[model samples]
Target: MITFQLSKQEKVVKSINSPSNNISHCAFLACSHSPQCTTQNKTCCAYILKHSLVFIDTFFKHHNLSYVIIYGTLLGAVRNKTIIPWTKDIDIGIIDMTYLFTKKIRDELYQHGFHLFESFGLPRLCVHKNISNRTLLATYDRRHKPPASTLELKVYIDLYSMYRIYGAQTTSKTPVFLIKTGGSFHALISFQNRVTIDEQTFPTIDNIEEHLVYFYTKEYMHGIMTE
Candidate 1:
């Protein structure tokens, strides 16, 4: 029998190639499901929120388009002055835009490493990051699984189209603004104004509290805070 000795470089390469050493730093920590990993996940989500907002603001400004903070995101901005801890996404509404615009926005996002997914039959745009070889592991609770591939990319910005409803009895062609929610479009007649949240300014309904109640009901606010 002949015995062979491996060189330093060969040894290092062999160790790296071993199955035990193949685990990625992120994958190892994420798989552990420890509190530290949970905190890291939240931190990653926060970064995504900040970066996504900046990207959206830049894109809209370049396109000469205006967007309004709406839904839960609007509520968080108005009350907490920051993103809600439990909030997983951002919501914004564009007035008088068509679904065709989403295609353009998707293409623009692709250039910046984001992939756009449109909800079927709804004027909604969800953006995610492109990644490879990532799999979501079931959590201890089984209900909450950490985002598999796009660790920091789990956060998404939702873009909704606002339209003005045309009443059957009215003959005037004046444009109106309506927001779609729960599979139906509701009239939005509130005046919009600029508001600053976490040093970033965006358009929101002038009467924010009332607007939120109108869309989500007073009980919804209570539930959000309590739950």
Candidate 2:
């Protein structure tokens, strides 16, 4: 059974329970180029993205927190009805609720087989799966060679904090919400209403096309299609 022990700041420590080896059906060996292999791999990745979203949706709902799909993940959902074939990570934005419950969220992700690691620095969490200690060592070892083991090493999801900018100069045209990425960068986002993906609706930015233009250049649609 999975359990959580929270520190004063609510940082989660590893539990005594060992991580599970029962990989989900979405886990794939790696990507390949032969037409058949490419198709199968893309299908597998799309399934994983869908499953990951379901878990995220359930978690946020249980916590009574509001979240929205964003970035490249949203583009894929809106345009292709699935994850972009070349995309490696999922992105979501939560409105000012994650900080207070970091440990709880980390523990929950751990229970579901995700290993949380800091990206850019400590406390900014990026959760991943199918990445063992051995794989991590191989990544940094100079002598280690490719074609490396691809037991789903890159399945990860990024969580962004959404906050409203409050100040005297802020105006209506100023975005209602800011989605903070790692470090100091933030992307402006506005929530007009919701968007449906795989028949489940979730909040999204108003004028998604405009937001997409801001986040990606005018060539965004063309670029995403190439790979």
Candidate 3:
């Protein structure tokens, strides 16, 4: 029972309940990933992205990753403490110069029982696991996308790396980058340039070189996360 709190300028109805340890099959994906965001009424995924952000925040915090919600997620946290009624996805930003180490992180997630989609560098592309599965991690890859079928991605999350353009300048620009993994999907996935449709600025952390994070979890792979 998670408690739903509202932010300063809120519009969504909130429910005050304790957060649950029970995992659901949903993996928070982009707002456009589902049909519910456009429907007259919001769908379950849309509803959860608003409420479940706290859970994702908890995961990053537990992993010791200093992160802050951006885009729609941040808007919800700052304005409504809930997902915007028209929002269809969740986005979290990380600060760092994305090198070739993305694969290392993917491998680490694999050990945790998750399936790594491509090794980063893909646009509008993602990889994630079933949170509801007894296994903490599992990755289902849709490498070569066929014609009429939109990849049926179970709920997942997107992680972007932020870069600092210039250190000495007080007004140095900030931008989020997408890795180019080769091929149309992951391969030429460069900077999404603008993080959103409404804004032209990219998201960059003032201090990127110093604030990097890594997670250590062997429990999920070893079988179960024992209390």
Candidate 4:
């Protein structure tokens, strides 16, 4: 069972219950092309990611919280006009992290049919109620178990806090900062760029080419990811 625990400051629990391994339809690998994948099924992982991002974007806007898509999620958005066919989770950076820990936000998430949980040692928000099939296939935790009576799939959205690196002190003389989570830098980004996909606009780094090159090198424009 999923445990819902909340501290005075931290509003989420440790992790979710293990999920079953009966998802034969889940490829867990990037699709050769996203256009072919998303059109096939509504409950597919790609659609799950799309819907998850839409919800978060709307949620943050409604609460007046500033956020931007970053890392692989941003890359896919800029390149494919959709999430990477093999996207396992969503990544976003909030301008203010403290707002996420308040009791009000916690209640709002729960009221919206989501259970915030920690996975991979980092906090992530997840929901299963919005999807048509009502299944939650835990992406990272695939342990064999008797099929529970609840949903069989879980879509997790990883959250990171954005910070400004004040003062320009680089050789190129442009301010650059790192988005860190769990003591590791998620991405090196600068400036803000507005991106529109499928008529839905979202914020990203203005220098997207540099952002992609900084992480994926020049080949990213061709839809190649080299870590």
Candidate 5:
């Protein structure tokens, strides 16, 4: 197995091959009646995404970490009150990466019925809910099963590492700032701005329209397809 090193001594192991295999089962936790929960019932998918957002928001607030909703998640929050009806996964960017993999965080997550996993160097916050052991025991092949001691994966929220870069000027008086997501830098996002959805508030970037345009071009205002 491959391990992704975060710092001098901290590392995360790739426990699961692909998280997508279990994402479909998340809708069962929300509403079990539909076999094709994601496509047949869009509300079930949105419910899972909203639940993840609320939990992560509370977790970050308790730890006093700075974060913002980005990508498709941000677009939904700005245009609609909640996540996009069709979206199966949620994306969030946290400013602090140094403290993410500490033992304290792991302990706290375990206490709250959550687990952390890493894939391709990106962290994922997974919740343990209605997923059954029997379902998880069946891995890539239905004919074979892993050890009964194997842990299960439920619905998860994707976490991206973010950093702030200062000293950039824009057309507006406000000092144009940039947020570094992975290796690329994006323009104009402030943590000071906040948006509320379903009575739950989240930190967001300023100049929503302009930032959306920067990422999605001029046609972004009308709403476009997002994964």
Candidate 6:
């Protein structure tokens, strides 16, 4: 892992594999579904994503964390003011280390029609009504259905560990990461190369819904995937 100079002994997310400093020109949007799921519909899956977004946003807002629309969520935000009409899931993001404080957020949301799912040492996770507690974060869908869209509103969020570099392309894909805060491995990805998220000014607010499940140690975090 690459090390940077810091005054405090803080953990900085690092990518084990480095992409070129040039604008990332590669994109790997895996349009695939889980093996457990077969039929994925906008209504069923969108309900899960929508409920998840509301819960995440409201819970996090109570804790005063800073998050923003990311990836497909951001794209959808710009295109339709909501999840892409046909899209089945939603994506939101926060700066590194916010997940360290998710327990409190989870506890509070649980009282408001949410269910908490045990994640071992991972951050506290929750689900909407009727969602089953699985190892893959709590997920909920409208009942009376087999499965329309395989979109499971998993306890996953896009993490943007962008770097300070010269001549990065906004239109091209930039190498980005999604570090699970359960103190485990990290996930990597090439972001859209069009503009740098680091350059964009996300709204600064009091971060209330933060958790450690997304802010684990740097070493373990770097081992996550770039998929």
In terms of lDDT, the best-performing candidate is 4
> Over all chains combined, what TM-score does candidate 4 have?
0.66
User: lDDT of each model, Cα atoms only?
Assistant: 0.48, 0.50, 0.33, 0.56, 0.55, 0.35
Assess the local accuracy of residue 127 in candidate 6 as a C-alpha lDDT between 0 and 100.
39
Question: Each prediction's TM-score against the native?
Answer: 0.58, 0.61, 0.39, 0.66, 0.65, 0.38
lDDT of 3 by residue, 24-104 (tens): 222333334333342222334444443344444454445555444444444433334344444444655554313212555
**Regions more than 4 Å wrong, model 3:** 1-43, 50-52, 97-130, 133-156, 171-227
Candidate 1: misplaced stretches above 4 Å? 1-42, 99-104, 123-153, 165-176, 183-192, 219-227
Order of candidates by lDDT, top first?
A: 4, 5, 2, 1, 6, 3
Estimate candidate 3's alpha-carbon lDDT, on a 0 to 1 scale: 0.33
- How much is 148 displaced in model 6, in angstroms? 18
- Residues 33-113 of candidate 6: C-alpha lDDT, one tens digit per residue: 332232233223343445456556666667665455444554433333434434534444454434423455444544554
**Tens digits of lDDT, candidate 4, 79-184:** 8876766655677877666677666776677666454554455556655333233433323233444223223333457787666555434444343444655443
Give the per-residue Cα lDDT of candidate 4 at 44: 56
Report the lDDT tens digits of candidate 2 across residue range 154-174. 445666666655431333453
Q: How many backbone clashes does candidate 1 have?
A: 2
Candidate 1: residue pairs that collide: 163-178, 164-176
lDDT string for model 1 (1-227, tens) is 11123211211101112221111212211123122222224334443454557666787778777677777778767666656656656788776354224446546655654444433333333332232312221211223443343233235566666654444222233333455555443433344476666778776654566566766677655545511
What's the CA error at residue 212 for candidate 6, in Å?
Answer: 27
- As a whole number from 0 to 100, the lDDT of residue 118 in candidate 2 is 39
Model 6 clash count equals 41
